[model samples]
Target: MTDEEPPAARRGPTWLIVVVVAAALAVCCCSGVIGLTVAGSAGLLGR
Candidate 1:
């Protein structure tokens, strides 16, 4: 039997996982920025 594996099976779902992780990070960063902006604005108004 040949030891070499097919390319498709060797690289299964790696791209999909990277995309999902990037999307999650993007969402988290956006929310964090928005939350910080709101908090800063509130602080300024209170001062």
Candidate 2:
């Protein structure tokens, strides 16, 4: 109800936060892999 309250108490749910963070991390990892693959191919192609 107030700033003095712990963040968890004021927030809705821990599992929801966990799920969102996990999904974000998965996206970042997948994107990073795709980027690396593209870069590697580009290097081979000298582009």
Best by lDDT: 2
Over 1-47, each residue of candidate 2 has an lDDT whose tens digit, in order, gives: 67657786646678788889999999999999998889888895465
TM-score, predicted candidate 2 vs. hidden true structure: 0.64
Off by over 4 Å in 1: 1-5, 9-12, 44-47
Clashes of each: 0, 0
In model 1, the worst 10-residue window by lDDT is: 1-10
lDDT of 1 by residue, 1-47 (tens): 35556666566678788989999999999999998889888895465
* Candidate 1 C-alpha error for residue 1, in Å: 13
TM-score per candidate: 0.67, 0.64
